[model samples]
Target: MTTPRIVSLVPSLTEAVAHSLPGALVGATDWCTHPASLDVERIGGTKNPKVERIVALAPDLVVANEEENREPDLDALRAAGLDVLVTEVRTLPQAVAELDRVLTACGLTTRPRWLDEAEAAWDAVPAPERRRTAVVPIWRRPWMVLGRDTFAGDLLSRLGYDHVHAGHPERYPRVPLDELRAAAPDVVVLPDEPYRFSAEDGPDAFPGLPCAPVSGRHLTWYGPSLAEAPAVLTTALRAALD
Candidate 1:
């Protein structure tokens, strides 16, 4: 069987497909930065990919995420008669399952080893003795946080960090800085993407609370990064408390 040529709009999905099938990827978004040596036709960013360029590539399959991609762009691709595989992963289980489905669609006959390792890594995480309440800020200025049903929120919950805005109606809600502080969470969890929250920048905002500056990829991206996220995030979270 001929290997399917793939174009991945999501960075995590790009990494997953790249690892599973080395030569399978023919096009990927500029944001798909994993596998550092990955050389493929660079489409635009996730939110605004050049639809025409993707169609011109004539890939066998195009992988995208519901959250990372725009519906209109996907519609355009489908209109061009391309096979598109859209994945929605809001939890670890969903991620695990979606990875399998994606690789299979890319023409893999068996589950990749990295996927197995990622599942085992999450499974090995022991239940926390006590849960810590946190406010996870994705961006500042307007102050958007991880609210109800977010992948990051679900991942943090597994790590024993209960999101304060988990009950909010919006997935990513804009809250005033005053309200955020008033929530009085045990800690302020900060990931360094979609915003780049650093030790010097993010921690100063919440004067009295511990600020855990963690890797954005580990906190959010659902790919090979999941295997080390538990240990990496735990160390960052614990360092803030210590």
Candidate 2:
């Protein structure tokens, strides 16, 4: 079985999938910084993939996602007759599908037993009993939040938590703190990235509501890593609900 010489064109799954596929990855975008120890070659970012630089790496397959990456690069890569595996993940199921596709494209089907363990963990994660959650994704000017139709919201819905702004049609909506108060989230989860929600940030408008820091990667990036996120998220959700 020959492993394909792979290059990851997206940053979100770069570091993680690189480690999972073993020798399949030959290059990745400059932002692929997860397995921090591996010295994979750099291609570029979502907008600027440095096509010339990527071509130089001579990858047998290039993996990319639809979120942050642009379409033109995909077109150019396809036009050049490169073997590209593009995955568009919008939901948790889609995230799992993306990982499965990557592994299939890399020509490795027999995944480690840990993958089953991870899937079991997700399956075992008790569904949220009563919908209740105040998921605050960011801490910044205008105060952004995950709303209906966003990946975070989809996950929140799965956990049985009533996402504070899931009613809004927009994805990440910038609203006044007052608006959040009106929504009144029972559990306010501040994620660790993009906005870096912190306990030191102090009590928000809510007095008795449970406020805690959460993992941005688990909530945001749905992939191989997410297989383990159920335990973490379940623990957090239980803590918040309890």
User: Highest lDDT: which candidate?
Assistant: 1
| List of clashing residue pairs for candidate 1 | none
lDDT of 2 by residue, 3-113 (tens): 678888765567556656767778887766666776777777777898877777788888887766788988888887788888877676676667777777777667755
> Per-residue lDDT of 1-242 in model 1, one digit per residue for the tens?
78789999999999998898999999999988898999999999999999999999999999999999999999999999999999999888999999999998899999888888998999999999899999999998889999999889998999899999999999999999989999999889999998988897655788888889999999999989999999999999999889
TM-score of each: 0.98, 0.85
Please, what is the whole-model Cα lDDT of each candidate in the order they appear? 0.92, 0.72
Q: TM-score winner among the candidates? A: 1
For residue 39, give model 1's deviation from the true position in Å. 0.6
lDDT at position 109, candidate 2? 68
Candidate 1: minimum summed lDDT over ten consecutive residues — where? 200-209
Q: Name the lDDT value of residue 41 in candidate 2.
A: 78
After aligning candidate 2 to the native by TM-score, how far in Å is the CA of 220 from where it should be? 1.7
- Tell me the number of clashing residue pairs for each predicted model: 0, 0
